[model samples]
Target: MSTTTTAPGTVPAAGTTPGAAQGPPKSRRSRRPGLIPTVVLLAGAGYCLLPVAWVLIASTKSSRELFSTFTFLPGTGFTRNVADLSAYRDGVYWQWMLNSLFYAGVGALLSTAVSALSGYALAKYRFRGRESIFNILLTGVLMPPVILAIPQYLLMAKAGLADSYTSVLLPSILSPYGIYLARIYAAAAVPDDVVEAARMDGAREWGIFTRIALPMMLPGLVTVFLFQFVAVWNNFLLPYIMLGDDEKFPVTLGLYTLLQQGASAPALYTLVITGALLAIVPLIALFLVIQRFWSLDLLSGAVKS
Candidate 1:
């Protein structure tokens, strides 16, 4: 082969010279951070977090100090608030917390499993009415829980499920959004070749799904679990409509009751604020524990299947 020589001090085209500049360098505008986006994000974070900060501070205040002192001022009632909340209704606040944990934990687990299996089948299998089924599921996401709650309650009442744990739970187990996420994740994270190979090895379909596909799809499943967990934990409307007993109440419902009581007795204002502050501790702890399972790569389809 003949060697190609380029003009002196000039960048050569590909194959003309080795290690030559290909094009002009990217501009400073392209490399530097976008100022507007950064400011907007900071503003959004502050807006969301400001109320939480207020709750933390306000929980520390006694009912008298709540209005008397500055908004951000710390009072000496932090421990006292905990004691009062603990003593209220024979520590029913803890019962509500336990109920919420049970509901969210069981609901998230069941939701994640169903979503994973449904998503995998939808993604991997070729069946009739598959798209229609998925579309119907997605339609549920459009219907807000507020609009659906009354109807759900009526149905539960007809089925003798009203005022029962099943009424609150069964409705929450099927998450349209979680199914959507799982489908996307399964499609992205599971390889067709791997699935085919498993089939050729005399492995059953369920075995392939449980052993081979599930491992690859774990990150996405974790994300679904997290979403459903938060949704069930923060849920108010379904429980409000379904359950009549205070013993079965979740933290959200319990707080609403306290607020109603606080309207009559201003002393309960401190209890309400303190309960609200304590309410978020579990979620914070959960985030710290499961933060690693949340990956942009899995969500954005950046990881190889």
Candidate 2:
């Protein structure tokens, strides 16, 4: 009487056939997704994208096609739409674009710098009133922009600086949320021993920060910069109230005025939509460009460099 061993994953010598000998029947759990979550997620994505999708499609249509045709289909008027936008008011749209760049670029750079310094200080140092200072800045985060904008406008007026570029750019530079993010980043990225090593080499505190901590904190700072950039770029009320001149308007306020006019003209509706589409183009482009450089882990301060 000879016995043989079966190969792995094969049926054993039970008193049954190959398919049935190895094990009991496997359970047939359903692999399909439940209806509710799938529907909810798809609905959310559609809700978020419907406006954006509409803008992209609408920006391609002429004023006539915009009203006459179905909403979702692309049109042949993209070139003409861009040309008309380019030709509008001696190309004031370009000026608004430039103004938005100036406000967001300058404001975000300054805000990131201040947030870095303040955050580094709070994270590393143990000076008197440190907690108090952080708490005060946190309070600024809770304060509504509506509340601050009025007082800021009043103060700028007293200083004879209302209706100017400075009035728009200056107030936005001190961002409490940016500081908060910076603090979290600094605490995580920066190490005590590195600062101690720098100090041992006779490096000043500012030198250590500029040379050592900043390089380590760069990834997180990009997030602050990007956040503040979008915030300033999209800001309408501050620039609207502070700057009366259309030439000084950022794209948001500028497009808003165009929309107001469109209420009567109706033709300007296409231009307004076109301008909005153009305004968002750079943001999408910037995200794609910086996405490679951004270390998302730095947002959580998980990186140890």
Candidates' C-alpha lDDT: 0.90, 0.91
Alpha-carbon deviation at 282 in model 1, angstroms:
0.8
lDDT of 1: 0.90
Question: Which ten contiguous residues of candidate 1 have the minimum total lDDT?
Answer: 296-305
Candidate No. with top TM-score: 2
| Candidate 1 TM-score, C-alpha based | 0.86
Error of 2 at 130 (Å): 0.5
Model 1: CA > 4 A from native: 1-33, 294-305
Please give, for residues 83-172, the per-residue lDDT of candidate 2 as tens digits. 888899999999999999999999999999999999999999999999999999899889888888899999999999999999999998
lDDT of 1 by residue, 1-305 (tens): 76667669977554645655667678988855787789999999999999999999999988788978676878898999999999999999999999999999999999999999999999999999999999998898787889988989999999999998899889888999999999999999899999999899999999999999998898888889989999999999889889999999999999999999977899998999999998999999888778744655456556454
